[model samples]
Target: MMLFAVEWQPPRLDTGDLARIAARLRGLRPLESILDDIGDVIGDQDPPAAEAPVLAERLRGDLVRLEDVAVAADDRDPRVAHLVARARALRRREAPTAAHPVTVAHLRRLVGAAEALLERLTETGTLRACA
Candidate 1:
């Protein structure tokens, strides 16, 4: 049997509803990358007709969670806020192509956005236990 590696979903956005919009300025860890990776993988899947939309919607919900956390935390740092904006744009772009044109470059861009957010959070200590 081919074994699939189990991945853990970080708890940055779910740390706390209130903490979702907070501050961090020390170099710790990056959580955005995790979110992005999750989205990229989900968006790139070729599930059966019954499962494709469900997977897409789940991925969208995850992105929305990050967006909500970022918006809540934007008051803490503008970089995080900007990351949120980029993620939102990517989400919108992915929605149209969820089951059609899932390109490698597109995946890279999505992951890149997440990486950028992680770097900012790590440098700023916004993602500690969350990462």
Candidate 2:
């Protein structure tokens, strides 16, 4: 009888996704800073009338950046769709137009949503240790 050899191969994990996720996580710092800025604006009891427009423009710029990142991530992985939707919703929100008390509450919600999304993103990892 002739002996035959069989080879076993390990399953492959998506390392590219991990690398992209890592990059995206690093990209979150600027968004976090903008969120802090929003919080500060919300806390200001007597923000000058002129300040509202500047704050709105700044927040809009950062939220647009966030939307771009979220959309790209969602395109890569549909699992990120929910978080992406939240980013879109916040971008379209009227709260940032002015920092009224209602806007303050909305800004707080926005911050919470962003933190949750980041926390969820951090939970993503490759199935294999080497992956």
Candidate 3:
């Protein structure tokens, strides 16, 4: 039996909100963080029976997906070697199902690498402003 002390519902995300959310993801922070914030907003509306576990799952998925992006970037652009390595490291850290000191450190590395790559692409005229 599902016994809930409080009724809950996630936030409503309009199409326009999603578009702006996507743009923020391209910023300095990791996408996992953005997912967490979104989840919190969802929880605020629906008040999840519990929030921590669900948020953790969302974050984990985001990291995994980011790792995939790193790998694909690796295959397409050998220049992204550092980012690729950091991504693989992050995947390994997250695969264990528990956080460690190294995990945080590695996450920072991945974010830095991703930011560097973004900067390089922008500087080289590969990615246009606001595009």
Candidate 4:
């Protein structure tokens, strides 16, 4: 049953590089994109209630995107450290489970937090300087 063995490693973080890149005029495009996806599920144009399974799947996927940014951020930097802390706190709430189904309201909180983080990054970041 054994094929080949593979090793696992934690993600490597290089905040300086990330900041320099994100600070580009192009901006936080990836982060903004995930926000749009989350919006479709929670946006007013959509119905108040969504199917549980679909909502859960979307919720899990959005969290994974946030995790990517969190992993790549350096905690030594105060701004990114704060965002990372907020993301970890959200994780403590945990992802959706059958025993503890989450609602759109929960997703709203996540979206709000994410938007705030993005605002902070763009506002204080090098993106401002170049413009």
Q: Which is the leading candidate under TM-score?
A: 4
TM-scores across all candidates? 0.45, 0.46, 0.32, 0.48
C-alpha lDDT values of all predictions: 0.57, 0.57, 0.49, 0.56
RMSD of candidate 3 to true structure, Å:
17.1
Q: What tens digits encode model 3's per-residue C-alpha lDDT throughout 23-108?
A: 87775455435434444534435323344345434444554555465555444555555555654554455422345433334444
lDDT of 4 by residue, 47-109 (tens): 245454465455555555555654565324476567657755764575454332245556566
Clashes of 1: 5
- Cα RMSD (angstroms) for every candidate in the order listed: 16.3, 10.5, 17.1, 12.5
Error of 1 at 14 (Å): 22
Query: What's each prediction's clash count?
Result: 5, 0, 2, 0
**Better structure of 3 and 4 per lDDT:** 4
Q: Give the runs in model 3 whose Cα sits over 4 Å from its true position.
A: 1-100
- Per-residue error at 22 for model 3, in Å? 15
Q: Tens-digit lDDT track for model 1 on 51-101?
A: 444545554455565566555655478777787788788878754444444
